[model samples]
Target chain A: MGRPSAGKSTLASHVEDQLVEAGYPIENLDGDDIRKHLHPDLGFSREDRRTNNRRTAYIAKLLNRNDIPVIVGMITPFRDSQEQARDIIEDEGEFVQIYVKCSVEAAEERDPKGLYQQAREKNIEKFTGVNHPFQEPLNPEIIVDTEAQSIDDCVDDVMTQLETLGVLDERLDDDYSFSITRSEEQDITERLEELGYLEE
Target chain B: MGRPSAGKSTLASHVEDQLVEAGYPIENLDGDDIRKHLHPDLGFSREDRRTNNRRTAYIAKLLNRNDIPVIVGMITPFRDSQEQARDIIEDEGEFVQIYVKCSVEAAEERDPKGLYQQAREKNIEKFTGVNHPFQEPLNPEIIVDTEAQSIDDCVDDVMTQLETLGVLDERLDDDYSFSITRSEEQDITERLEELGYLEE
Candidate 1:
């Protein structure tokens, strides 16, 4: 979780693509995507923000429980809301909270969505790190300082954390090592093409 | 989807359990559960109901895109919202609209959540089928008449629909015939026990 323009969605999508390349099926749950499709009526009120975070958390937990890892990118500003999500998801699967740290000034200068300008101009209400406060996570599993690191480096940091947590490269046993073979890759590609999910 | 006490959750959960038993990992998106955990700020307003339905549909689409089938049980009172859900999900995966049909009288009589009585006594506002309207689907993929059929029969009807849609028991080609055998089951059970998800 991080402020706007901190590259949360970019990092999450990068991780999802890398996981797919590693033969792991994963899903990208972006805050903007969820808001566009799921909770269009939700405003930026505190209650609405909490509800949206909880919504994303519930979907992530469901996907994780089904053996599909999910990369969630959201501005989970409230500590309580983030903790609530952790409590719910950690019951079924691991909840690795990654704090994408960036200064408000840096985020405003980046202005990825122009949201910071809107908040600065008083055009938007309850904007995180602008008008509203964003409580930093006290105990995040990983912290990638966006101001000091490139996007690739930040993604590498997250991947390293996941590896340490035994999420990626989970070797079952010496006798049961698993890896994607050339034929399996070809089969997956063929299936994707047949399903119209990809072009031949 | 049907009225508040139309037994949608029970039916959906049963179907999910059956799918698990059939070696398919599935997720059940329940209206009440989502309201409790995800959409706590949502009320019975028409806009809120539409947002909730769209929210569930988005999550279902995400899960389905990740190769996990989803069974959604929501009192989707608006035809436009249902159509919107179909449009969103059908783009990625199959969208089977199951209209669980039951009489308003029967639903009120069941009063599963005691909500029907509240609606009848004017204690609840914007209650679907009482204070508000529940627009029936113009062309649902399947219709299970809860008033006429037993729960088992209703589930059977849904299973048959899925089978006809080629969603269930899809024994893949010989080249990729994947199934969990007895030893695999034992291994999985042992892993779950070790992970403290099952009794030791």
Candidate 2:
């Protein structure tokens, strides 16, 4: 759970691709899915944000119970909302609260969607880290220092933390004994082509 | 797929167990999940039902694209809502729409939740098949005659239809050659206990 433009979606999609390529039963839960598809009528109110948090966490919990690990990229703005998500998800499976740590100035400067700029210009109301507050998680399971490190380094840090936590590599009972075994050039690429995603 | 107390849940859970036991990547997308967890405030309105249908279908499509077969057991009361779900899901993957055909008489008699009785006593408002109409799908992919057959037989019919349609058994790319490989009784039971779900 990180603030917008803190490389939350970037880090999420990268990790998600890695998991998919590895043949794991994975799902990427984003706030966008909840906001756009599930709860489109909802606005950026505190109550609405808390509701979103609970719903997404519940979804993750359900998926996790069925043995699917979900990588959720959400900007849980408040501590209460963050705690609520953690509590809901951890009830069934592990909830890895990742803080994509980036300064508001850096995030604002690097805003790809210009959301930060919009917030600044008063185009968007109740935007986190502008009119609204973005509370830093008191104790996040993983903290990716996006401002200080490269994307690869940030991803590696999160992956390493995941390993340390014993989340382990899982798929359709295709246990990989922890890490990616086939490295050394040509083999890994060929292996990816062999295993297909669900669309096929 | 079927109305309330039409043995939809029973059939869904049975099929779900079979898939999980065989180490398949599966998720059961139920209307109950949306109504209870995601949109608790939503009432038994036409718009609410359609919104619920679309949201569940979207969730199913996302999972299906990632290679998971979702058994969605929803009482899609209108053909438009049913068509909407099919369109959303089939955009990415196969959608098997099954009709658990149980007459209102049989369903009311077998109302496990006493929902029908409540609806009759005016305790529940806008209940499907009570005050509201349940428009059957024009042409469902499968129809299990729950009124005529036993639960086991009904399950068999649905499974047969699934196989016929080539909605082939899928898991984490673990290609099973069209059927359950080792089903000699003792071996199957042991296999389920070994291939642990996500909670483990």
Candidate 3:
């Protein structure tokens, strides 16, 4: 969890891709994508933010229940909210909070949406570290400083952490091999038919 | 949006049943089910609640995009989140915000989870009305008073609203028939086998 344009989404997506490549069933819950698709009715107020946070955590928990490790990327600005998320998951130490730290200067330079510039120009209000307050993480399990670190380095750090946690194992390799032989294409077509997307 | 134990889930399930029975593809996104299955890590804090609301909306929008009307039951306490959800769907008036309006007394009386009793005993903090705030809808599309109205009445009201909103074509007879050819099942089975779910 970090401010917008902090490379949180990028980092999480990279990690998800790596995990997928390593043959683990994974889901990346990106905040923006979710906002557009899931909770379009909510706004960026304090109350709305809390609701958004809770919903995302609930999705992560669901994926976890399905034995899928979910990598979530959101501008979760509150420590209390994060703690609440951990409590909801109930699977102790499974919820890894990775703080993608970056300086305001660096974030401004890398503002893909030009949001920081808009915030500075007073075109956007309540921008994190500008008009809105961003509560820094007191003690996140992992910290990746986007200002100094390369994407590859950040990915490597996350991969190393996953290995240390023993979340990935030889079973993943076996699953990949098994999946290649399994008929996934047939399953997709059958599912499509069951949903009435296809006819006789 | 209303308090937990306010019959939100029960009502949504009923509505979904009616829609499906009317030959419409329906999906129900219940808060409890989502928390248990999708977002195991999320809790019921202000921020967390907002996130939850947003995520539900996102899923609803996705279903809507696929021409499926999703019925979601959540304690969305804030209006901003609801508005955001509308924006995400982009289709004007597609989001039917049915405020399951019920008094705290009524909710407590129907306390299926014993949550209200706990809240009254101060065992739980941030209990919708007992501890936390619940913003009443200023202009909800439909208001179902569970305390005064019968389940049948409530269901009828929703069905009428859906019809009025053109969600259900009233002209279509209740006994409208569609041919269910056995060959369709054979085709689906063949597709499933191709997908590798069935043995060749």
Which candidate tops DockQ?
Answer: 1
Error of 3 at B123 (Å): 27
- Tens digit per residue, CA lDDT, model 2, A84-145: 88888889998888999999899988999999888888999999988988899999989999
TM-scores of all models?
0.80, 0.83, 0.50
Q: Write the per-residue lDDT of candidate 3 for residues B1-200, one digit (tens) a residue.
A: 77777788888888888766656666677888877755667787888787877766766664554445677888888778777666766652277778898899888998999999999999998888889878887777788888889888988887777666655652243334543322343477689999999984
Model 2 chain A worst lDDT run, 10 consecutive residues: A177-186
Best candidate according to TM-score: 2
| Candidate rank order under TM-score | 2, 1, 3
Q: Which is the better candidate, 2 or 3, if ranked by lDDT?
A: 2
Worst 10 residues of 1 chain B by lDDT: B167-176
Tens digits of per-residue lDDT for model 1, A37-156: 777777888988988898788888989988888888999999999999999899788888999999989988999778888888899988898788799999999999989999999878
Each model's DockQ score: 0.66, 0.40, 0.21
Model 1 has a clash total of 0
- Looking only at chain B, model 3 earns a TM-score of 0.81
Off by over 4 Å in 2: A20-25, A169-200, B21-25, B169-200
Model 1: share of true interface contacts reproduced: 1.00
> A30-102, model 3: which lDDT tens digit per residue?
8998777666676877767777888777666655544556788998887778887877666633777788999
Q: Report the CAPRI category for model 1.
A: medium
| Model 1 C-alpha lDDT per residue in residues B18-112, reported as the tens digit of each score | 77876677888778788887767779888888878877887788888887888889989999998999998997888888899999999988887
Classify candidate 3 by CAPRI docking class. incorrect
